[model samples]
Target chain A: MEIDYSNIRVIGFDADDTLWVNETYFREAEEKVGMLLSHFETPNKIDQELFRMEIKNLPTYGYGIKGFVLSMVELSIELSNGTVSNKIISEILRIGKDMIDKPVQLLDGVEEVLISLSKDYKLILATKGDLLDQERKLEKSGLNQYFHHIEVLSEKQEANYQKLLNHLDINPTEFLMIGNSLKSDILPLINIGAKAIHVPFHTTWQHEKVERNATNGLNYKTVKSLREILNFFKQN
Target chain B: MEIDYSNIRVIGFDADDTLWVNETYFREAEEKVGMLLSHFETPNKIDQELFRMEIKNLPTYGYGIKGFVLSMVELSIELSNGTVSNKIISEILRIGKDMIDKPVQLLDGVEEVLISLSKDYKLILATKGDLLDQERKLEKSGLNQYFHHIEVLSEKQEANYQKLLNHLDINPTEFLMIGNSLKSDILPLINIGAKAIHVPFHTTWQHEKVERNATNGLNYKTVKSLREILNFFKQN
Candidate 1:
């Protein structure tokens, strides 16, 4: 798919998998949690239970370590037939805590693409995560220098995108959102009349996935890698 | 400071430092970038150069990677005597791209306090960031469950807060804004006739920083920690 990049003044990127390999790390931690849970419950059942807790707690907690820890606690109790030990709970908490310290690894060619795109378009790092964690990764990876502003937010929805546009003083039509998650990046950007580039990651974090059918009619283009963005810009 | 929790039917949270640490991460990264620039230019000069680029790009790109990368490239070119090496440029670009993979670490006790408050108040996560990044954090953190609605916005200005209240189908007076940034969370909430709790984070993110004093006579209280929220509830 081609897009006219000439008129586009600002390009907003969905951090995580778009510019770096965030989901894979998250998946690694999640898999570990799943393994821990499997010691007491079936993998499917553990996932179901945790998912139920997530849905139940979303309205009150929103997101982060507090919620993740609470979900583990809830899961442990359910899996252990109400006899979950404090050790098990603490172990889960420890794992949740440890995930935050994991090292960040960038996706291939992310730097070249960002630099190339930055020359022509205004760039923003629009990412979400625990503020400290996101900051640490940026600091460690040495990527924090490029963005003029780094937005660490709570969720990605239509309102968030609108707010970003307002803050940047840009129109949705002039903005381009690039990211991996269809649910968070593509859907929200498209809904707000902003252009979006969908870069599909091989392993999606559990929470970033959405029903594919919901992405209908969103003016989003797909790419397999970051370098494709240049081609997208050239063709458009 | 004291507030009546019983009268508060809805409690909103500011995403950045209020619930988690954000600015310190950026500061760290910025400092690192400054250090990198210092290898060729004076620290003050580097700061000035980067700040100028940031100010210029923010209005065009908003917040995130696009603006950041541009700033780095511009700085490199300026520092390199108008001749930027591909290697140095790539390094800068790498730093910009690496920001997405950062881990998410929640502020201490944020979850526990929010969980306790959720039982009594209709909780909402009112934060502004990159849409996709915020949602991913929310999902991963397991906090998405607590918020009946999650608002990821671009700015937390007065109008934005007002819009949030309107969207939630609630009155401003019935809501309380709890956050770290006095500018975005406190002032806006108070402007709309709502109560605000300012829980100052030790490190404030640059963008959300008030950069000024409160002008309006807002009904607000300042707290040092999230646990104080319980006290606010008891008093009111």
Candidate 2:
């Protein structure tokens, strides 16, 4: 089934990993946490525990470096049986601040794709994370000019995209979303009758990883890189 | 100079204290933190340090309970000279979770005013906080029906409001903003040439405090309660 490109008036790009190097930082932070708590558990166990902590606290803390740091702190205490040193906890805080301060590293050809698309479509950044953190990254990425505005979603479920289309005063058929996460950016949009293109990031968060069966019959395109998206709109 | 609100076409309400009990919870959390760290410093000193810590980290953490909790954890480690117990850190995390899980408490006459005004004007929630947190509160408050949608700003300054108006495609004269803080909700809107009404909350965060002269000549109304707003909009 060939998806029509003529109907999409607005295009939404996901920020983390899709536009910039994000999940890589999280992986680095997780490795740092594992090293910091080596006395309590092995690196693999620590990784498993940290993932559990994040999922457990997702409802209360949501997503972002701050919440991720909080989960690491909680996991540290639990894994160490309430004996985790204050120094280790302090180091975790530093790790979060460092992540927030890290320079915005745009993924390859992100700017080119955005510049090419912005001329023909109203481009928006539809992402799920801490609003300020994402805004700061956008400002630093120097791609703010190409976007109509940023839409920070709490979650990227089907209902969220529906509401976004409704808010933007565009129909689902008139919208297209491109992102790295199939769970967050692609499947939901496809389910909602909107077009989606997957630009797979080298690293994806464990929570964002979806099963192959989930994408089985979906009518969205998956490209090896974001730059390839330009090919689809060339003759428009 | 009698400011004319006859041209107002859209209204923005600040969610925190204007529609619900927000600052009060922060204050309570502060008191709890003071108790947790009493052994390390006097209550007065602990309060001062926490305020200083939050202000210093504001640029990195922005505004929200997750950041607040992170700040509290850092302060505990600082006050204890790196010996703060893991148990105390765990307790502070609990305080933050409790704050987030708190039920939305609407201020007096909030629903009545929303019900009356939502009929005649396009209403929106203009606020600064975690996006997920604010959306969750609106969902819990049952006042979601009154708002066309929620606008979460990273900061509620003159420039932010201007951007908001521009995005909504409404002129300053066509917009009215109602809220509790003179700094965030009132002055910024007025500075942007939008009509504003002040509804004072009993407790304002120290960071939100402004000098008397800042509001000396601003042409905006100050109401004692959210209910009083209904009177001003009756003619419309």
Candidate 3:
């Protein structure tokens, strides 16, 4: 069955890995955390525990560098039986600050694609990251002009996308989503009867990794690069 | 000169402390932190230092219970000379979770005012707190039905208000803002040539305090409670 692009009046681009370097920094931060806690546990063990801690606190902290850092601090204290040195906790805080301060690194063809598509369709940034951090990155990325709306969601479930569409005053068929995370940006839209395009990033967070069968029969495009998306929207 | 709200077509309400009891919880949390860190500093001294630390970290953390918790943790480490017990840190983490889990306590006459105004004008929640936290509170408050939109802003400055008006596609004169903070909800709207009504909350955060001279010549009205504003909007 041929999928349709003619109905998509608005396109929501996920900010983090889809537009620029995000998960990479998180990966680096995790590695640094692993090193920081190596005295108590193995690097692999530390990584697993940190993931567990974040998931445990997801309802309380939602998603962001601050939450991630807090989880790391908590994990350090837990792993060391409430005796983790304050130096390690301080370093974790520094790691989070550094992540927030990191330069916005736009991915290949992001600007070009946005420029081309934004001329025809309304472009919005819909991400579940912290609002300030995402807004700061958007301003720093120098691509703020390309967007019409910026939505920072607490979660990107089917209901959230529905609320977003209603807020936008658009139908599901008239909206399309694009991002690297299958769990967050793609499947949720597809489930909600909207369109989605998957542009896989090199590194995926453990929580975002989905089983192969989850997308087995879902109808969406998988482009290797963002630039390739232009071909689908080019009117004949 | 009498202020005219006859031109108002949309109403924006500040969430924290405006619709519900917010700052009171923050104050209580501060007292808890002071008690927790009493060994390191006097209660007054700890309060002062924590405020200083929060101001220093505001740019990084923005606003919310999560940021508040993070600041408490950082302050603990700082005040103890990196010798704070992990138990205290864990307790701080518990404090954050409890804050997030706190029930939404609506201010007197909030629902009555919302019900009356929402019938005549489009209503929106314009807040600077965490998006998740604000959304959760709104859901719990049972006042979500009265709002047409929920906007969690990074900051409620003049430019942000200007952007909001633009987004709402309404002229400044056609919008009215009602809230508890002079620095945030009241002054910014007045500066942008929009209508604003100040309903002062019992407790205001130190950072949100405005100098008397700042509002010396401003023309916004000040109401003693949320319910009083209904009198201004009722048809003659």
Candidate 4:
């Protein structure tokens, strides 16, 4: 479909993966975590167990590297039956720290797209993660200059999008969200009558991946890269 | 000191230890952590080391129990030189889990105070911590209805307060912040010329405690309890 965002006065961008490197780091960290626990379980089992732990710890740890670290600790003890070395635990913590400290490598042409969009649309960062971590990444990304508002939402369900748009005094018809996760960035906006474009990242976290049913009825466009998104804007 | 709050149009409440039980849990957990690590270091030394670790990890872990747990894990490995048993590590993880699961027990008269103040002044939750965790506590506290806006600041500094007030379209002269920590809640607001009331929580985090020099030149009220603050307001 030929998408038109001409009516949109506000454009919301997802911070992680879409604009900068995020999920890829999480993927690499999971590999390191698997290797750290290699003695207790197979690499595949460790990966499976880590996901379970992440889902279990969500209520307490919520989402982010902090939660991920905590889950790895929990899973290490479970997998090792309390035999995992303290040094290995420290290594896991280091993995999380390294992830948090990773440079905010923006996606290809992300800044150019944002720079172009900012002139015509009020841009906002709509993301969910550790508040300080997200702020640090945004600051490091040097892309904060392009955004009028920054939101670290807890989740991206339909109600959240509706509330966010309404809170900003934006009508659904005139709001557009460009992001990487269909679960987090695209489907929710489409469900709320707001326009959204899915700019798929190289790697998506398992939690954010959804089936076709979710996107079947959703009206949104998907672009290969952030650079392609500029073509959707009427101003450009 | 006799204080006047008649000029205050919006009253901000600090979350965590102020409205509900927070620091006390940390203290109890510290005691448990010390016992768990008693072989590695003296309880007194363990407590001191934990505080230092917390301060060190603030940049990565930020605040709240999740960071505290990570620091405890790091401290465990340090105290044991990587020989700390995985069972003890699991115990430390449990310490953190218990904290996050604790009920939001509002301080005596916190609800009544909020109820009374919400009638006349616009109430806002001004807090610093993990954003999602704070929101969860706020949701569990059942205090969401009282707030006109909720802010989970990354840090409580003069610049942050200035930015927050300006963004909310609030003037410093008309704003009042009531909380337990003088550093996080009182001084920052006072530095920006905002009215403030400090209702001391018994167990203050060492990081949140400041020397009397911090209070020397500052002009703000100190109340024995949250309930007493109602006397300062004309409504009650």
Q: Pick the candidate with the highest TM-score.
A: 2
Candidate 1: interface RMSD equals 19.9
Arrange candidates, best DockQ first: 2, 3, 4, 1
The recovered share of true contacts, given per candidate in order, is 0.04, 0.90, 0.78, 0.84
Q: Could you give the DockQ of candidate 2?
A: 0.92
Question: Which residue pairs in candidate 4 have backbone atoms (N, alpha carbon, C) closer than 3 angstroms, thus clashing?
Answer: none
How does model 1 fare in lDDT? 0.70
Candidate 3 falls in which docking quality class?
Answer: high
How well does candidate 1 reproduce the true complex, by DockQ?
0.04
Per-model TM-score of chain A alone?
0.90, 0.98, 0.97, 0.96
Error of 4 at B176 (Å): 1.3
Which consecutive 10 residues in model 3 chain A have the weakest lDDT in total?
Answer: A227-236
**Per-prediction TM-score to the true structure, in the order listed:** 0.52, 0.99, 0.98, 0.96
Q: Write the per-residue lDDT of candidate 4 for residues A78-98, one digit (tens) a residue.
A: 999888887788889989899
lDDT of 2 by residue, A1-236 (tens): 66679998999999999999999999999999999999999999999999999999999889999999999999999999999988899999999999999999989999899988998899999999999999999999999999998999999999999999999999999999999999999999999899999999888888999999989988999999999888889855
lDDT of each: 0.70, 0.94, 0.92, 0.87
Task: Name the better of 1 and 3 by DockQ.
Answer: 3
Residue-level lDDT of model 1, residues B1-236, one tens digit each, is: 33555667899987767766566666666777776667788888887778787776554334554345545655666676745444455455456545544566788888888788888888988877654556666766677778766776656778778767775778888898888888777887777789888888888645566645454445567777788778766565
Model 2: clashing residue pairs? none
A55-146 per-residue lDDT for model 1 (tens digits): 67554444554345545555565676655544444455556556656667788888888788777777888876545456556777787666
**Error of model 2, residue B24, in angstroms:** 0.7
Better of 2 and 3 by lDDT: 2
